[model samples]
Target chain A: MTSPWAVIIVVIYFCILGLVVGKWGKGKEKGLNEFAVAGRSGPWWLIMFTVLATWIIGSTYTATMGYAVMSGAIGIYMAMYSVMGLIIFYYIGPRIWVWGKVHNLYNLPDYIGRRYGDRRLAILVAIAGFIIGAPWQIMALKTFGYTTTALTYGALPEVAGMAIFAIAITAYCVYGGMRSVVVTDFFQGIICVVVVIGGIIACIYAKFGGIGPMFQQVLAQRPEMLVIEDTKYWTSIIVASFLGAYCWLEIFNRIFLAKSVRDLKIIARGAPILVGTVYFLVGILGIGGSILASVNVDLAAAESGLLTIFSEVGGPVLLAFAAIIIIAAEMSSIDSQIATAGVVLARNAVNEFKRTKLTEDRVVKLSRWIIGIWMVMVYFLSIGELPALIVIAIVTYEFLATMFPTIIIGALWKRGTAKACWASMAVGWIVCGILQISPVTQAWFGGWGAGITGAFFAIIVYFAVSLASPKDEKVEALFAEVEAYKEAR
Target chain B: MGNKLSRKSKTRLGFAIYFVVVIVPILALPTLNRLNTAEPFVGPFPRIIFLMLLDYLLVCAGLFALYEIESRRGDLL
Candidate 1:
């Protein structure tokens, strides 16, 4: 059943990507800045693509696509939440970038550490972020397996496929670090935009005669696909993603990677249009996908929409391309995660733990080793079956949502104290952690997510303690520094 | 019109506009978040899909407007 041509095609694609990425990512290993954040000089267009590529992980295609197939247009709520997140980041992110640029920060927790002038709070945030973030890496690898196995027509076992990517991604990230990830992201993002999204639109046009006719069938035959079954679930998930905009460590680094605040603003204004349009087109593909499949299958139901569309369209070349783009999307995300974890471990955990007097190069070297080990460990863990991939994704989102209240208020409000930061973050993280693992998903509380409900406590405590708590004397200087940076620019 | 407004009032207005943009779909749930009742074909889509499309376009446009205001005021960073 394995297609010799499919393996040959994917291998050829990888070879080309490897060569291009190697060239761009070369000479970037000389400094930690190049490795961690691409020396903080990414243009607006590259930042826009890389940010979208990194955010739209494999589960986005698989799980979110599956939701769209089942729930109809309501499934586009994933894209909506992301749009909300980007918009929120539009306002909040540039200010954080100002602080980051001044302090030469790489990670989200690093900003928190510097903002509160508390190294320990940074450590607390980093450790929690790492714990919650690790599951996503695992989940993506499982998707890597599913996509590879399905695409290759069983040419290779899923474990072999996962191993191939785990090794390949680890090699490049270790070699070129962030530069390689960003370079490869441009490739992946392009294919995603050109091939994957383009292919979907082409399917509706060529197969169904046009978009209108395709939806006419959906309207006429699969009308239930358009109905909103759980409106509350829809509202809650979008709100959670909106609030947890920057909880993602990769997105946090993307903000720092922008060339300047203006470039970031351009990105904030422009990226939503591009990415939102991509999702809108892809969302339209879902209705068509449902028309192609039996409507009432489970969430992880039937073969992927792309697979069915391409296979039915009788294009092996197109099917292979879609599979590769999906795989490339997975690699883009996992590479960012591995790259971030390595840097955070080196800067926040290793150096801060002992207050090590190590040189910056030494720290960078340490991170390289950590990146290798982290990937190896995740690779080994990824070889197992994980039917709960979507569950892990949801729980991870809830955990990261806990970081929102502290991150926003800490960056915005002058009265925010290091004391209040710890209390509120601790309370939010603990309560959200409990609620995420519990049976219900805050079903009774206006249909919001467990994470947002838990964050309700975080919000109250943040405001209450912020009002009563004594301010850190350094906070005024920090605010002054921000103002001076503003005036200077 | 822009020069007379204080930054605090501008921020409050920004938040008010943002919440409305974000929640407009929720308001639509009672009416538009249903099957293709009012019209079966809103061009290429069912009525609901068109509304969802309008909702996110609103989101993108609304947020960009806020960003422009902040950019003009030198408050983006």
Candidate 2:
């Protein structure tokens, strides 16, 4: 059972966080642009931390450790998607930032719509972004729920845990919007890095003296865990994960908030080191968990390995620290997703469909309501037992991965027409859906992995259709404008 | 401090890092796995772990160098 002191500490932590939210987020409410994109004026430091915090959600803690425990060295491959995605972003992010600034864009669909000159495609992609994006929030909430329940030894039920987290995240986001989210994210990001690194260090000291001994223990006792047994799954996951990196709208949305294109480039350079250090530490913790399990640590669930290790090695204090880190990671991600989803729904879906000019204040209000609705939906979905966090996350990535050709090719290649964009998206989704749900197809092509297969087909179809379709004079003109804009920069 | 190099040159450099740091490591994993036998420990870590850590460090260093060079060239935006 959780100590009463720990509970009090957590309650105090929440109150403090709430106050921070109120201080920075309150009275900052403004038009939809300020609410959604922080007036597109975030500095490199803020952007760096917020982006890192947003990406390194609860799954980064739980799933990385889980994969490491399950697959040994191959578990480090878990960071493949993020690392690759960030690197790719180094190139693409500046362009997107510049485009968003040049066009007064607010979301991915906004960019797509303006780029393709198709409002309907924008709406479709917005809906698709929500569909693909919502699951990640749900998964993060579920992770929060499960992790909290585990921390409290079931004194707090999963539903109650989910509700607490959902309410806390929703309140802050509703109050402050993107400014609040980014501010809180900067704070939360610091907590995560400190606590996670601290917890791992404590675990090493308490359990096996140091890194060298812990690794030696694992090698001696559980050598098989050190081997990369499944080569096909390993390779497929790396490829699919690299592609999956681009699919996240929340990450893409950060491009819009960048103060300048230079800020994006700076972030791109520094993000890998930030992400690498944290994930690498988590990977080491996973190795520690594997060693602990070898000695019969009685981990209740594989997903809870990191927490369980903390409890066993560091006692209540360290466990409480671990709890805070997990909560910080979850909340940072949840708030960002909630805020981004609201923007996508309101600006792209509702506002675009209405074709009515709403006041900035009204649009902000609508976004808050949509955020509330999204929170409730995610809360309900999170209550049920779902697939493993990584599996669900990857599946979501596969769905979003369909947008790659449109996002990447459409930006660089002017031949991409609206019809081609829609066709590629539709065909990719259908193929991925078939591969995901059908047992026969999964078994037949499971080796290739559904994500990679779908992406392959999506890319092929995108190029074929774009080549066949006649080039639009408007698109040609837009590309020329984009080139001139680049030259001006 | 990032004005010396053109955006195209910076992008090309980014792609080059992507190929060397991201793509090459992933492609070489299969071949690396072949050597994942019971090798002696390099310092505290196993051979594979040491090699992976080396790869990660190389990526970190490469990215840092890219940023430093670009930043030195003058402001990009």
**C-alpha RMSD by candidate, in order:** 3.0, 3.6
Per-candidate TM-score against the hidden true structure: 0.92, 0.91
lDDT score, residue A329, model 2? 86
DockQ of 2: 0.42
Off by over 4 Å in 1: A1-3, A294-303, A387-389, A437-447, B1-12, B15-19, B27-40, B66-75
Best by TM-score: 1
Residue lDDT tens for model 2, A125-203: 8887787777778888887778777667788888898898898889888988899898898877877887877778878
Off by over 4 Å in 2: A26-29, A294-300, A355-357, A384-394, A439-446, A476-489, B1-7, B10-18, B28-30, B74-77
State model 2's lDDT: 0.77
Clashing residue pairs for model 2: B1-B73, B1-B74, B1-B75, B2-B73, B2-B74, B2-B75, B3-B73, B3-B74
Return the lDDT, model 2, position A39.
Answer: 85
Q: Write the per-residue lDDT of candidate 1 for residues A1-489, one digit (tens) a residue.
A: 345666677789989998998778654348887888888888888887888876677766666677778778777876677777786667667777778788888888788888888888888888877887888898777778777888777766888888888889989999988878888888778877787667877878887889888877787788777666676666666767777878777777788888888888888888777777767766667767887744336555533776667656646777777778678878888899889989988888888867546677887899999998988888788886667865786787776777776787778787887778778778987877767666475555655668777778788888898889887778878878866887897
Docking class of 1: medium
lDDT of 1: 0.76
Provide the overall lDDT of each model, using Cα atoms, as 2-decimal numbers: 0.76, 0.77
